[model samples]
Every structure is written in C-alpha cells, then in structure tokens.
Target chain A: MAYELYYWPTIQGRGEFVRLALEEAGADYIDVARESEGIAVMMRMMDHAEHPPLAPPFLKDGDTIIGQTAAILLYLGARHGLAPKDPAGGLWTHQIQLTIADLVAEAHDTHHPVGVGLYYEDQKAEALRRSDEFCENRIPKFLTWFDTILARNPAGDAHLVGRSLTYADLSLFQLVEGLSYAFPKATGRALKQAPRVAALHDAVARRPRIKAYCASPRRIPFNQEGIFRRYPELDR
Target chain B: MAYELYYWPTIQGRGEFVRLALEEAGADYIDVARESEGIAVMMRMMDHAEHPPLAPPFLKDGDTIIGQTAAILLYLGARHGLAPKDPAGGLWTHQIQLTIADLVAEAHDTHHPVGVGLYYEDQKAEALRRSDEFCENRIPKFLTWFDTILARNPAGDAHLVGRSLTYADLSLFQLVEGLSYAFPKATGRALKQAPRVAALHDAVARRPRIKAYCASPRRIPFNQEGIFRRYPELDR
Candidate 1:
C-alpha cells in the first residue's frame, strides 16, 4: 500500500523532515494535506480516530497512522535504508533526530517568544531579546554540537550518525537551510565555527535525490508564514 | 550491566522523565550525576565521547550512551515492556511522549521567555505575558489533548497506551505534578476541565513503586531553578 502523509500544505515546517525522508528514498506517497479537501481531511483525522493524533504531519499507512515528525522518520527510516539496522545505532540516530526537533522548537520560539497563538508584532520586543540570545548562545551551542557530532563520526564527517545518510543528516541539512533563511547573520557566524557541519550541509544538498527535490516545486520555500520566519530587525 | 543515568543533581528537570521510568520499572541504575564528581564525569563524557551527548539526562547502558529523554524511554520501554510491543503501538506511545516533551519545554519557557540562561527577574515583563498565554492557551490545549487521548483509550483511562502502563503515563504524571507546583491556580483550574488526565495523575501517584519513589529523596523537589518554577506573579 502507498503511504499517505498529512501535513500543512504551505509551509516546510516540521513536515519537511518527513518529506525529505520520503523524497530521498524515492518512496511512493501522496502529500495528503495538499490534495483536494486536504485540510478538511487532516482536521477530521485529528478530530476522529481511535488513536487520535494531537497535531498534523501524521503519516497514514493502510491501518496505521503515525504522528510526530521524529516518530514518522524513525518508522520510515527502518523501512528504508535511512537508519541503522542495529538497535544501538538506530537508537543513537533517533536520539540525534530528537535533538534536532529540540533545535527546531527553539528556533520557532525565537519568533513567537510570547505566545505561538499571538502575533509576532505583539511580542516584537520580547522576540528581539529571544533572537539575540539564540543568535549569540543557542545557535553556537547547537551548531557546534552538530559539528562535534560530525567530527566524531568515525566513518566520516559527511553524516551525523553512522556512515550512512540517515534521517538525521537530512534534517540537519534542512535545519541549516532554515536557520540561514531566518537568521542569516547569526547562522553564518556560527557556521564559520562549524566547518564540518557546513560541509555536511553542502554534501547533503549535493545528493542526487535531495538536489532534485530542492530544484523541484515539491520543496517548499521558507516564508514568513512558516516556523522559520525572517524578520530583519530580530535577526540582528 | 547497570544503567548509569547522568543529569544535574539539583533539579527534577528533563531528567525526571527518565528517572520516573527507571524508578517505576525497578530498573537497576545509578544516578551518576547525584554522586561525587558526577558533574565532572558528565562534562568529560560530553567532551570526550566518540558520539558526545549535547546535554545531560543521557543514559549509559554497557557500552552505549543514549541521550534525549524520549529516546531513553523508547529504549527502555522496548526492552522492559514499559511500552507496547507492537510497532504501531510503540510508535503511538512515542508520539505521545514527544508531545509531552513539547509541553514540558513550553512550561519552562513560561518563566524564561527571553532566554534560558537569563534570570526570571531579567525578563519579568515578558515572562508575565508568556505565562498568561501558557496558562490560558497552551495548558488547556495540551491537557485537553491528553484528556482526549485517555477518553479514546479502548483499554481504559488507566494507561495512556494499550492495557498496561507506558513511559508516556509516567511522564504525564510528572507533567501534572510539575504544572501543579509551577502554576497551582491555573493548573487546578485547567484540571477541572481534564478529569481523566487529573485522574491518571492520581492513579500513577498511587502505584506502589511510584508512591515509594515519590516519597523517597531520590525524587527532587520542584524549585525556582527547575523547568517548572513557582513565580506568584507569573502564575497569576
């Protein structure tokens, strides 16, 4: 059976991580949320289910519907060659994915520091401080960690986990892209200190499938409506 | 080999989720950071490992080091039957755990809206607004989702997944306890609307091992330094 992915149609947001996995694997699937009555289908699924998904970006197999970006990646990873076959290696890869999720959440909070439901305008001042701290401290901390992970990978610095291009490497590639769009100056500054991470990002981008995905209309561009928004003043 | 748990000794922060899982399972483990030179050992491990952990609350099992609370719980749940045995069931349980992690991060941000490293006093105004949004919006949304998950559970409201307890249940118990201490008035008000979630908290509290662990000094008390902090003004 073909897989069905349900996520917001417009933004790359969390859904992009799952999309990257599906795209790179050359897997057969439909962006369910991008189909006709997609949004309604997504909402109804969220509202009515035995095992209800709390939010979107859920993947529906014949009888199973898996929610959570990282969980979806894990399920897909094992099915494909995206993750390790062994328990130890797989667990480590999953851990790295979880940390990437953390970094993503923090990046979103930089723009919506006061409340996600509230407008960024209402919390501009608060966001300024949040962004400043993120740019100065969090970005360096996270990128350096990624750089270390890359440097320490005995197989090579090309992947975040083992020698293979796991879901983590794909997610990290997206992360660097999102950060560069949202806070270019800060991310650029951090990237200088994380040469290995930068190299991995570039290498992931050069992969045939990912490179095609990026060049295709299938890959959504970063915008103000997405989690990683660009507000010039806050970026400073 | 015994599991070696490493985290900051002072606060029942993110590590509490891992701690609760181990304590409930009656797993043989050492809270390494609670021992002497524990902090140094943790830092050195973070700096020296082939796959260095980004932060603490990492678990060491024989030769492997597992970071991320949800990842650790996933590993333990599979090996110990603390989670469902089936792939679908396990994935759903993991999805719930990730949502709980999201809730925990939001709860922490209520008091640290500007930055994690910044003091509450330094961002008092921003925190007040953040707390208001959390207490009024995020808390209700999350608890309502939890309540829905329980109400939909075919087995019963006794557990978050399947018939038996999962790590998600234990984490939910901790979330309730943390929110209650951090925002007593708001949490009490919200709990009235989420009886199943509230009831789960009470049920988990009565479990023999959890009860003993709660009474034991191993369970660190919530403090200003922890994720769930008590700031009377912010709570209001």
Candidate 2:
C-alpha cells in the first residue's frame, strides 16, 4: 500500500520536508490533503484515529500513523537508507535533524513574535524586532553549526553523516531554500560565511529525483502564508 | 562507566526532562555541570566533540554523546526500558515526546517573545500578549491531546503509552509541573478539564524513584530564569 501523507494543501510548510524525502527515494505515497475532500478527511483522522496527531503533516503507513516531522523522518530515514544503519550514526543523524527542527521553529517565530493567533499585521512591531535578532544571531548560529559538522565529518564534507545522502542533507537543502526565500539579503551573507553548507544545499538541489520534483508542479512555491515568508521589510 | 549529563547548572530547564528519566531508571550518572569548573569543561566539549551539541542538556554515555532533549530521552528510554520495546510503540512514544517538546518551546516563548538574546523585561509587552494566547489556547489544546491519548489508550488510562511507564509520562509530568509553576491559574483551569492528564502528573510524582528525586536537592527548584517562569502579570 502507498503511504498517505496528510498536510495543509497550499504551502510547502513542514510537510515539504517529508515530501522531499519520499520524492528523493521514489517512494510511493499520496499527498492525501491535496486530493478532493482531503482536508475533511485529514481533520476527521485527527478527531477519531486510534493514534491521533495534534496537527497536520502526519503519515499513515498501513495501520501505523506517525506525526512530528522529525519522528516521521526518523521512521522513513531508517527504512529508506536515508540515515546510517549503525545505531550510533543513526542517532547522530537524528540529533542533527532535531537541531534543524529547533532552527525551523525559530524561523517561524520571526514573523509571528507575539502570537500565532495574531495576524502578521497586528504583530508587525514585534516581528521586526524578532526578525532582526533572528537574522543577526539564530540563522548564522544554526547554519554555522551545520557548516562545522559538514567540515568535521570523518568521511568528508560531502554529507552530514558518513559519505552518503541522508534526509538531513535533503532537509538542509530545504532550510537554505526557505531562508534564502524568506531573507534573501541575510541568507546571502550567511551562506557566504558557510560555503560547505551552501555547497551541500546546491548539491542536494542537483540530485536527479529532487531536481525533477522541484521542476514539477508537485513542489509548492514559497509564499507569505507559510513558515518562511518573503516579507521584504523583515528580511533586512 | 557512569553517564555524564551536561547542562546549565542553575536551572532545571530542558535538562530536567533528561534528569527525570535518568533518576527514574536508577541509572548511575554524573551531573557534569553541577561540579566545580564543569561548565567550562562542558563548553570545551561542545567546541571540540565530533558530535558537538548546539546547546547543553547533552548526555555522554561511554563514547556516544546524544543531544536535543527528546533525542537524549529517546536514547535513554530504549536502553533503560523506559519506552516500549516494539518499534511502532517506540516511535509513538517519541512522537508524543516531540509534541510535548513543541509545547515546551511555546511555553518558553511566552516570556521571550522578542528574542532569546533579550531579557524578559525587555520583551515584557510582547510577552504579555503572547502569554495570553498561550494560556487561553495552547495550554488547553496541548493538555487535551494528552488527555485524549490517555483516555484512548487500549491498556488503560494510567499512562501515555502502553500500560507501563514510558519517558512520555515522566516528561508530561514535568510539563505540567512547569506550566503549573509558570501559569498557575491557566494550568489549574486546563488541568480541571484534563483530569486524566492531571492524574498522570500526580501519579508520576508519587513514583518511588521520582518521588525521592523531587524531594532531594538534586532537583533544582523552578526559578524565574528558566524556560518556565512565574510572572504574575502574565499568568492571567
């Protein structure tokens, strides 16, 4: 049976991370929410499923449902050879993914500093202040960590763990893409300082399956509504 | 060999979640940062370790170093039998722990909405607005999810997963503790509606090892500087 992925229909959001992995592996999966009546089906699953998710972007494989992007990736990564087979190496890859998740959460908070419940317009002042700190500190801090790990990898700087392509590399590509889209000026500066990270992002982009997925209509374009918004004023 | 746990010495913060797991399992471990000159040692390790943690609350077991609170717990949970042995059940436990982590991050943001670099007083206005939404919506939404899972558990409503104690139950207990300390009024109301969750929190508190750990000075008291802080003005 093909895996069913349920997420918001319109934006890349967190679901895109999972989508990238599935696409890269050529795994048979359905973007459930993108289908007709999918949103209702998604919400009802949350309401009545044996193991309900607190939010969207959950995956149903057979009778097992997995939620939380990192946890989902952890599941898929091991099964698809997208993570190391050794327990220690696998755990390290997961640790890196969780760190990426921390940065992603912070990135989302830049545009909604006051409350997720409030509109961006209502929280503009706070967003401006938060965005400044994010661009100045958090982005560089997180990207530098990635660069450091890539440079320090025993195998080489080619991948985050071992010398193989893992989900972390795919997700890193997505992170850089989101940051570049959301804060072009700031991401440009940070990328220049972290060449290994920048190169890895580009390398992942060039992967045949990933490249095709990007060119295809299946890949959702970044917009103001998603986690990484291109609010020009907030970028600088 | 004794496990070495590294974290901020003064506050319970995220490290407490790990500490609770270690304590409950009666695992022999050293609180590295609590020893003299230990913070310097911890910082140096982050600077040079092959798998450097982005931040503290990292655990060093033999040569393996695990970071990220949930990731650390996942490692400890398996070895210590604090998690289910089955792969599917283990993943579900991790999923719940990750969700709790999301709420913990949100809870931290209530006080530092503008930036982690800025002090709470500097972001007081933003904090107040954020706290209102957190208390009114986020708390109930998260706690109710826990309650729902507890109620829906096939074995019984006593634990978050299976019939045995998992790290999710311990972490849920800590989450309730932090929320109750930080937003007593809101948590009180939320807990009233999430009786199963409330009972789990109480039950974890009374567990032999956990009970002793909480009473001993080994457990740091909740203070203003940690992720969860009591600011009466924002609690309402």
Cα lDDT computed for each candidate against the true fold: 0.92, 0.96
CAPRI quality of model 2: high
Query: Can you write out model 2's per-residue Cα lDDT over B40-91, one digit (the tens) per residue?
Result: 9999999999999999999999999999999999999999999999999999
| Model 2 per-residue lDDT at B147 | 98
DockQ computed for model 2 against the true two-chain complex using alpha carbons:
0.91
Task: Evaluate chain B of model 1: give its TM-score.
Answer: 0.98
> Which pairs clash (backbone N, Cα, C closer than 3 Å) in model 2?
none
Give me the displacement of residue B137 in model 1, in angstroms.
1.0
Poorly placed runs, candidate 1 (over 4 Å): none
Q: TM-score of candidate 2's chain B against its reference? A: 0.99
* Model 2 ranges off by over 4 Å: none
**Model 1 reproduced share of reference interface contacts:** 0.88
Interface RMSD of each: 0.8, 0.6
